[model samples]
Target: RPAYIGERVVTPRTPADPTADSDKVVWSQTVSLLLGALCEKSWDTEKV
Candidate 1:
């Protein structure tokens, strides 16, 4: 017999807290900006 329904899988990693520290927020933004810059550079090279 074939199974008709699928089982749900849960992730081991937990979600971040909504009320995170100010330092954590600042660091996250800084890293995001760096990644964005890198992506833009790569995209520009591709267009050339």
Candidate 2:
């Protein structure tokens, strides 16, 4: 049902900046470790 489902190609209006998303990230090893442990207990490895 989506436009790209067939042979249509989707292109962004502007070139993507690789660092653009990283700029918004809150880098914290503490949070990463907490989430990693939580994910291990919950068996949701995809989130980590």
Give each model's whole-structure lDDT: 0.57, 0.48
TM-score winner among the candidates?
1
What TM-score should be assigned to candidate 1? 0.57
lDDT by residue for model 2 (1-48), tens? 555411221232333753533332333445667889987978865655
Please identify model 2 stretches exceeding 4 Å from their true place: 1-27, 44-48
How many steric overlaps does candidate 1 have?
A: 0
Enumerate residue pairs that collide in model 1. Answer: none
Provide TM-scores for the models: 0.57, 0.33
Q: Compared with the true structure, what per-residue lDDT tens digits does model 1 show for residues 1-32?
A: 65321211122123364344444556667877
